[model samples]
Target: MLADIRSRLGGVAGINFGIGGPIAHRIDHLLSGARAGIAIKFSGENLRTLRDLAEEAQTRIAGIPGVTDVAVESQSEVPELGVHLDRERLARNGVSFAEAGLTLRAALYGAPVSRVYEGRNAYDLVLRVQEVAPDSIAMLERLPLRTDTGALAPLSAVATVTRESGPNIISRDQVQRKIFVTCNPAGRDVASVLADIRDAIDPLLEGKVGYAVHYGGQFESAAAASRRLLASGLLILLVIFGLLCMTFRNARDATFVMASLPLALIGGVAAVFLSGGVLSIASIIGFISVFGVAARNGIMLINHIRHLQSEEGVAGFEEAVWRGSVERVVPVLMTALTTGLALVPLVIAHDAPGNEIQSPMAVVIIGGLLSATVLNMVVVPALYLRFGRPVKNNGGAAGTPGETFL
Candidate 1:
């Protein structure tokens, strides 16, 4: 039924169906996201070429997997009436083109020459040409126009009427002509679908100059968010490094804490994959959050070892590492368990409506903590033992804040 309406309306109308809830839609828009799963925008100077490209793209895009509801924006030429005025004839009759145009406008459109006020309302009083002849090509030709000589002459003497076709609307982007090839994706991740689209179209458009392709709608927002998140992630890593160095008072220890991030992320990624969740902005945020937790765990265990060596005078490196790991077992388990339990609802109900943004994050966090807690226990201690060599100075066993275990 909707397709029928669109076909009936032809090139004169456009429609877009919004997907997802109001909040999600707003976020998508703010991120410059796609309305459809796949949207390809072709921009160039020639409308005819752009139209052909859009049509060809529409056909090709529909062939790709998971693509459906493929539609190209309307660029079909619409039938129009063209009027050509003969300047010589109008000059010979001492009639200006403006005069003829005004007369024709009044005849065709019923010119509002006056207004009548009644109570609080004002009504337009219009005057129009009478239907003097049956509809025919000769009707407009036979219409009379008054000349400067106060004589009526047929308008056919001064003008010619012909039928032509033109685009119903011309769309421009950044002063260049643009046409859209839109498609919806089902049963696939947007990133995968977009990759396929690019792979399919890139070769065709590669050497073409002054013509460009852009992905719009949801892809737009996704790309923008990805770029922003990447930059933010870099800055976050820097901040984390700075804070760790400040707290540990040593570059090696700080670097060790940072190293655990990848180990923790591995489990998070695995969890998302096992849960059949796509990597989205929410997942990225979850990974970033998990990094902080992983670093915190490393700090807790390492700091505890240093405290034990300084206060209790533990002599062996292996022993100090073992005691530290055992002491932190309860705290680490409780922290990870509490966080995972809190997010259990989100993880379990990931597919529930309105949970699209939260589920991926919960899954990542829960999985990351599980791995990070375990790895921080074993791997961080091993790394600490290997690199955290004790420095002695000044004739006594003077340690750089427990740098020397003995």
Candidate 2:
């Protein structure tokens, strides 16, 4: 069936996780993280006697989302183990089907036969062989069979044992039989898609199947980490913006400096995605670095624009803009080159923890700085030339039109 399914689907990369017996039981933690495929379990009056519920569970679990495959390890062919019971060995020891059946019943059957009265409370006495003592196949082989001569004989002399390699159990948290019903999203976020899958299954989970379900994986981790990174960045950005306001002593200039962040972020995010990387913790931290770097470049450009307006006797927009951009070009390039070069070690280092922290950050900073530097050198200066028309000669160099207008 798996071969047929694969054939029907056309060629695609896949990882097979199912193994017969109780192996699925150990996969609960791992399953929580599955982005694709299904985990399964089987339980019924028929399965009540076997160690292999995993195949049954998988059959049912295949119905869950993101589950493309529904293969059962237990159900997969093991033809030799499929041979009928050896009745010839049974007859040799006078172990006819009826007698052997009775022996099996006595070995496995349990019932609350009677209650014993003591003082005040009566407790029911349930009869069952202690499982660990004698119910196992090994113990059963050593069981004494009564011969026609009334002699006790070992049952092992009658029947040979063949270990059945099949499903053992499918359990969740040490109880209940269960399989994973995975949800695989085409393009949606793993977290959002998993949530949608769970929501869809809410009304669908009939507990009548006698199993449990769960969700987990990369999406879960990403959602958690994204929340943390967002909060941290917001706090840091606010703090940095506040410091800029304090240092500049002018809210207008500080606002212009802050605009550099948007200038930097566009290129940084584009580069990150182009590199085939997600916005992981490393990437977000890199993004935070962009803010500081962009702000620094903005400050430099603004300072030069002020100088061009004041000392250079720059009259109107274009002259101040051109002079500001040209004069600040060498300094901004030096600053960016120095910082970018310093981070080269992090980009090349593979195993260092410090390298992990710095690599994405350096990449983001490098990309954002390159962008913002160009913008600061070109657009910012042009804007300064256009808008920073200072009415001077008496008091002081005038601020830009936007600040006065605001």
Candidate 3:
């Protein structure tokens, strides 16, 4: 759709499109506040120099692959008429500078002289000299000004009018004038496009004084959010590990359960790779949830093995392991099957509306469930049997003679 729209707008300048849904647009607005594309801000003391630098940067960025809608954000040369008042000429005409300025203003822009009352409502009566047109410089030059001596003089005798251009609006950051050279990424990611822009512009800014460049908008927001999410993910892992330790009351069992986390990762990462190779926030969240589920399955299996020995008086360690795993296989498979089946639709309709976040999450979860379920049932039990301590029954030591492995 965006490509079709861009083609339809052929030859039209200063217009561009950004692809985003309502929820994504709102989230982006909250993150960057009206900045729709990647923005490179150039700041300096001189407005002309800043504008020039921005244009140069825009030109450099436009040549990079996958960059589109390259343009300067500020209007640096807006046309206007400039009026310069001559103090000496006003004095020679016996006219005060203030009076001459007021007369010229009154002629160009009407002055309120009186008010008319109608039905308790009053309207200001304005007075001004009539002209051929509102913006006619010839008419303005012939406008009359009254001096203190009651003499009339043409406004041109005391003022000079010229056509010129200047900035329509001057934007400032940290008290320095700033201009933004912005562009959108078309076929590539923002980070890759920005890397190319930096390489292109670095030489242009070298040895330049009183000027600096800063990246803003989506690039800035994504970098910040990535850092925060990384920290949060590490914190989540630590919290999960602590809870597992508290549950089993032994470091060995907790460490054994954490092995399932890597099993989940094997499938989750593979799923994301198969689905466009994009690792978004939703996929990371799915990984986190999968880790918890994997740990829960390990906990359930290990607890059952201990229960068979301590409570049910199973004689041999191998017998207890076999019986416990056989008993718990149904529950573990049921959990994985139910969750994976529920997410199958989301994985299939990955490009549907409102499923942008959910689809990637479902894909990761489903993949992780497959790997974690198979490995947790086999690997986790093996690790416990090899390295785990023997469980003691209410009567005495549980395992048969010569059968205790640890």
lDDT of 2 by residue, 79-122 (tens): 22211235777667666666555444455554577999999999
* Tens-place lDDT digits, model 3, residues 146-262: 888898898889889777778989888789888877667776767777889889887877888988988766767677777787899899888887886666566676788888889
Task: Estimate the TM-score of every prediction.
Answer: 0.73, 0.51, 0.73
Model 2: residues >4 Å from true position, as ranges?
1-212, 307-318, 344-359, 386-406
lDDT of 1 by residue, 212-266 (tens): 8887667666777988998999998999888777776677867877878887898
Between 1 and 2, whose lDDT is larger? 1
Q: Residue 330: error of model 3 in Å? A: 3.0
The per-model lDDT (C-alpha) reads: 0.77, 0.57, 0.80
Task: Report residue 300 deviation for candidate 2 (angstroms).
Answer: 1.0
Clashing pairs in 3: none
For model 2, the run of ten residues with the poorest summed lDDT: 74-83
Q: In terms of TM-score, which candidate is strongest? A: 3
Q: Model 3 — which ten-residue stretch has the worst lDDT?
A: 397-406
Compute the lDDT of residue 371 as modeled in candidate 3.
96
Off by over 4 Å in 1: 1-37, 42-53, 73-79, 85-103, 110-136, 143-155, 164-179, 199-213, 272-277, 341-350, 389-406
Residue-level error in angstroms, candidate 2, position 93: 37
What RMSD value applies to candidate 1? 6.0
